[model samples]
Target: MALAGQPNVGKSTVFNLLTGLSQHVGNWPGKTVERKEGTYSHNGISVDIVDLPGTYSLTANSAEEVIARDHIIKERPDVVVAVIDASSMERNLYLVAELLSLQTPVIVAVNMMDVADQQGLKIEPEVLEAALGVPVVPMTATNNRGIRELVEAVDELTRDEATYEPKRPEIREDHRAVLEELEHLVAAHVPQPYPSDWVSLKLLEGDDEIMRMMEDRLPQETWEQVHEILKEHEDAVLAVASGRYDWVGRMTRAALVRPGVGQITLTERLDRWATHPLWGLLVLAGILGLVFLLTYSLGAPLQGLLETYVIEASARLAASALAGGPSWLTSLIVDGIIGGAGMVVTFIPILIIFFAMMGLLEDVGYMSRAGYVMDRFMHLMGLHGKSFLPLFLGFGCSVPAVMGTRVIDSRAGRLLTTMLVPLVPCTARMVVLAFITPIFFGAAAPLVAWSLVGLNLLVLAVAGVVINRIAFGGERAAFIMELPLYHKPNWQTIGILIWQRSLAFFKRAGTVILVVSVVLWGLSALPTGDIETSFLAGAGRLLAPLGALMGLSWQMMVALLTSFVAKENAIASLGVLYGAGSEAGLAETLPTIMSPAAALSFLVVQMLFIPCVATVVSIFNETKSWRWTLFNVLFLLLVSFGIGILVYQVANVVS
Candidate 1:
């Protein structure tokens, strides 16, 4: 079945419920232009469902609309489950009317009924079904309510047992000749009792896609008449514009029933406090604070345990290998491989903590509220309210954040938003941020990390304003976003999600970071077998002069350079430079790296530079251009260095 509906009308949610799948659950899919299908069994009959991209109309003026329309006409599904939000009945019916023009068998699922009931909005399913000449089933896809009824309804409609009788309302008398031919000639070809007036209505809308579909099939004379008919209709959009709204009004007027003085529901009362600016900010802050507290503190102990065990195991394994292997081979296998693996493995704690917190917020629905709070600001940033999901994901990693751009409807908005995503100090930033800044700042790590995040945001805001002025160059636009009603997070879901994210962390540890770490270790190991004398050290000293521009010593410069490849390497490189397990000589080892200003500068540089390989790949995927990718890398690097230099120079000059 083709899942057709307006944007954010619970289409994806229904897809998730019916197919037992979750696909970012946004209104749109990302850059990949393809239709996705899933199959399931219902009432002992195998049912296949196609989740088409959401579209407001089938006029084919826009690329997305063309894609949505082409799929429905070309790859005809057994049934068209026209999912509609019960609350937004008037606006949604336009697409239903368009679908009916194709004479496709439709099963209207009035989804999000739970939400509608809570909002005190009631819909007459029978009256709606009769008006549209289709069966309507009131559904709550979340609780899986009325799903069976919807499926059965679709089954009966597509079986051809329940024939569709077109209800074409009155049309102007002048348009009758061409419309009459569409009814007779087109009807002979289409072989369905498709409405004469609805087809005529489409002709008036100047729907090129439908026109093109019928173009080559009909005779040459029919094509001539079709053009004449379109010309006669003159402004079809204007004609359909008048007709659709009036039709909607009539349908709802007859069918809709409203209760007088309906009491305020739970959602309305809670919405008062929830949407309050001050209280909402506080609530958001408190929730974020709890997330912060949990990420490091909860993950720290687990990290320590993992580190200790790995270190001991490596020591034992290295000593045991010395009996059989060559010295350098032993060193490569033992110190390089084991040490590299250990560092990333230790991050498992952080990963679990991060994903668990994110999943709870998203699964419980506060993520939507966070977006709600940020929406007005995002509009000013030239992005839609929906842009927050990707930005929020950016806090963890830029890959998913950039991937999240699929939900955005406008390419300009998506490109700008994707460009800005990397600038945010993600959780990957946290690995480097938490490790080094704490050396001098101590309890101020969170404060400094947050400050780096603030700086990123400040840059993003300034960049947005400038980009909007130059690149976007238009009036502010708004999005239709429904912040789902909040509920307490589920532990079982959170647990599974925590494991899901932790698995990703382990995969990185085993593959990406592990290989990079070994390479880093090898880079530090080669060229006279001395870090200060290695090729990297020569590269480090080149950076040291520029590092002095940021008030950093040679050692800190070396670490920062390594960080360009990956942020976590900044920490591991420092661990190598200062001697990881040498608390006995803390003063001698640590003080040599540089002063507080340099340390802070180092953190700033690492935080703002290009994200991991995954993020860069994502940028490439979204932009589909290498020039933009280079600009992102270099732009962020420039931002990092400029901020670092100015910060250190100011601090030094002040002192």
Candidate 2:
């Protein structure tokens, strides 16, 4: 089952009600529109449902709608429950009609009945059923009304195959000729029992998917005749587009009853304040202040707690193992891997807490406001208004935000955002803050962490200006966003989301991380334990010239290399190299590298360095090319190291 409807209709609520699932639902697949799946039981049978993105029609215009329509047309779900907003039948019915034409037995779940009634509009389910010739159930999914009726309808449609008479779009006389020709050819061959007129209309419209289906089956002469009809009009595709909307408008006027005045849209009032220049600016600042406070106040303690566990356990295990086991194996498992990997994994809960809160805000529709409020700032950075989401979320984790670029429209903006988002310090960088920032600056650790983040964001802003001047060479992409109405988030929904995200991290630790930890254990233990001559040590020695500038020794250089595998590995590499650098222990060795200025420069280098292997792998997958992956890796490495060198030289000269 897939919940298909127009954007901002009650589709998400219906999915929440039907599947008893709360996940981030958006308009694009893999971007804002990552495909979400959940399962529920009806009549003792578990049925799996996929929530396809909200698309306006089955025309396959945008990437999101195309993904949705392709899945339905190909996967052929057991049953599709089309959640239609009763209040906006005209726009909503366009999608419903397209689905009906697929011959996919669909039960129309007329959602937002509460809104319809409040607006003094009546939608009779029987009338809707009679009109569409399929089951129509009106319900408020949010309040759990008519849910039983919807489930029963889905059950019947999936089990019993009853062919319903679906109305095909009527065409004008000019297009009627093209339809007749298309109808004559597809009538006998196609298996799906969709109406002939619908198939004809699709062919006349030059709907590529359906026409390709016909071309593969139809005789050459038949298509030649169809092609002749298409070529005859100056812009034949427009004919079909106009005809369908015209037909949809006629059906909507007949089926839906609405007042001369629309009901008071709740979002309007909120929008006025949320988008107001002065009030909106303050609101955005408050949200940012709170988010910053959480990162430091709430997350710092948890990071400290997790770090304590890592340090104490590593010390005790190392002591006990040395008494009974081989020194090398014990050192590898206890000091090299556990001490290293554990340091990183300890921060997993804190990262999860941050992600969960961010996810909840996004689900309840508050996150978009961040983009809304940050439009002016984005403009100054030479980006469109909506670029803020990717930039902001990049601070949490660049992987999702990089993927989030699908929501951005322009090639230039997307590329610019993709390149610069990585500069924003991620949750992995949080380990650096909790571990080193305090050691370097004490009470000012949080402030330093935030300032570095702010500085990186500033760097990104300057880079954006350079990019626009060099690569984009045009105005920022057109920026418009649909701000959904605010509502109370369902926590049970948020908890499931947190479980999925955090458990994913834990699973990594148990499987991929565990294996890597073992491999890292072997790498760090073998050849030699000498800080200057081990394999990593040799590798670090090559970076000595670069390291001297940032005030980091080759040992620190090795830790920087380890950061690529995992941020925690950097800390672990250090425990083997440096002491109780406990969870609360300041990154005690950083100050020894050089002056405080060098320490700050060292932090900046770490902040902007290349992402982990997982992020690199994701980039490869997103680009579908290894060359691009290598390019990103080398570019960031050069950029990060270059900044470090520059900072060191400048600081030394000033001193």
Candidate 3:
């Protein structure tokens, strides 16, 4: 079975519900398109489901459309379930009309019936079934309504026991004559499993891929005749489209009942303010402020408890256990392994809170509005509005942000967005900012933190404008996104999302951070059993002259260097340098070694520094160019240092 729909039609929700925990995601063969497949047991039989890309139509104008069209045509799924939005049936029916032309078994799953009902709209499923001549299952996939009926319809269709033979749309009378004539000419040479009439229609529509294929397959005379017919009826393409809309209009009149005049919906009421240029930004700012306030207020205490009771105690216990062990082994275990892992574990609470809040925003459908609000501003930077999503994801992590560039269709837009993603201060950097802000500024910590975040955004916008002007010179892709209606968030979905994200973070802690921590510890512990004389200190001292320009000491320089491995490691390295037992310990020790000027400058540099190793690897994977990857690294290095120097010098004079 295959699931197909336009954006925001709950196709993904249906896939997740059916597949549960059995789904696997990978790239489609020889394409960058994501392929999702899963298995579910239905009545003692295992059923396979493929979730195709969400495309508005099967026209081969975009990569997603081409992939979806080819898959349904070649793979020949048992049943094609067209998921339609009940509230916007008129627009969604366009895709259904195209699906019907394929002459395959299709079960119309009228999704979001609850949403339609909320808007005072009535849909007659039985009337629709009569009009379309196919099984119609009304459902609210989010609430799991009518899922069983949908599945049973699929099962019956796959078993060849379906009751209805779907009524396919007919072209206009004049276009139908040309299509019939062309069909007769190409019927013998038409490819197997593809209907000759469909081929004829596509040829008339001037589909480049189909025209090329027919030219290669048919004899010269037949090819020329087909071409002549297409040339004569070149305007028949509009007629074909108009015919589909006509059929859709007739079906809708028979089945759909519109709400009374002057009826206002909840989505409409909210959109008045939520999408306003100025008020929307204010609302967005307030929402983000509240989310961060909650995150800090809730996460800080748990973080403290974890560090004090769980991590510190565990470290003391491990050190005692290794009392009789070799000295190097003991240091490696207590300092390298336990210390590194403990730092990562302490961040779980903060990350969980962040993920939960983001998931809630997404599930409730406000995030899409956020993208919409930023679309105009994004155009000024030569990017589509959809590019905001990946940048928004950067607030959580850059690895996924870089990967999220797949959502941008244009190559230049994706590349430009990828280059700017690293400038967004991720949660790891936030951890550093959260830790050091209060230590240096006391009552002004919140303001300082806010400023740093604002600064990151400012830098991102400026960098985007500069990069766009220098490297890219083309019209920005138009942003066309459907804002999903606001709904109450499903707690189960939010829990699953947080769990998956947290699990991925823990895996990274174990693999990348673990190895980097062990190596850094070796560099600090080897050759002299003293950090001052060890190779790590020597390296920092070599860079100390450069660090001095920014008022950063050798220790601060080493901490900054460790951040390239992972931003959280900056805090862990500070704890090691100061011999602090916990984050609090390091906080108390920071003020003694640096002034407000140097501390602020250090924070600035960390905010603008190169992305972590994981993110760098993701950049390489997405861009497939070491040249761009190295450019991002070198570019950030220069920007960070230049900003650091300016901040440090200005602060010195003011002080």
TM-score of each: 0.64, 0.61, 0.65
Taking the tens digit of each residue's C-alpha lDDT, what string does model 1 give over 374-404?
A: 6677877777766777876677666657877
Model 3 spans > 4 angstroms off:
1-203, 206-257, 399-414, 434-446, 571-595, 617-625, 653-655
Q: Write the per-residue lDDT of candidate 2 for residues 362-480, one digit (tens) a residue.
A: 88887787777778888887787678877766666666667666667776677777777777788777667566777768888889887887777777788778767877774755656
Report RMSD (Å) for each prediction in the order shown.
Answer: 12.2, 13.6, 12.5
Candidate 3, residues 1-655: lDDT per residue as tens digits?
A: 8899998999999999888999999988988989999988887879999999999988878888888878888898878899999999999998999999996788899999999998888999999999999889999999999888988888887777446588888888777777888898999999887788888888887888889999999999999888888888889889888889998999899999998647877898898899999998788778888877887789878888998888789889988998998989888887787776556777778778978998899999998898888888888888787788888778867877887789888889999999999999987898889889999999999999989888888988888888998888747666568989999999999999999978875775447667776887888897899988899889989989989998999889898988877787888888877889677888888899899999999999999999887788789989999999999999999998899889999999999
Q: Which ten residues in a row have the lowest lDDT in candidate 1?
A: 22-31
Model 1 spans with C-alpha error above 4 angstroms: 1-202, 205-238, 250-255, 259-264, 272-282, 319-324, 397-415, 431-450, 464-478, 482-495, 565-568, 578-593, 612-626
| Residue pairs clashing, model 1 | 30-406, 204-236
- Strongest candidate by TM-score: 3
Candidate 3: worst 10 consecutive residues by lDDT?
Answer: 505-514
Top lDDT: which candidate number?
3
Candidate 2 residue 389 Cα shift, in angstroms, is 4.2
- What local distance difference test score does each model get? 0.72, 0.72, 0.87
Error of 1 at 606 (Å): 2.8
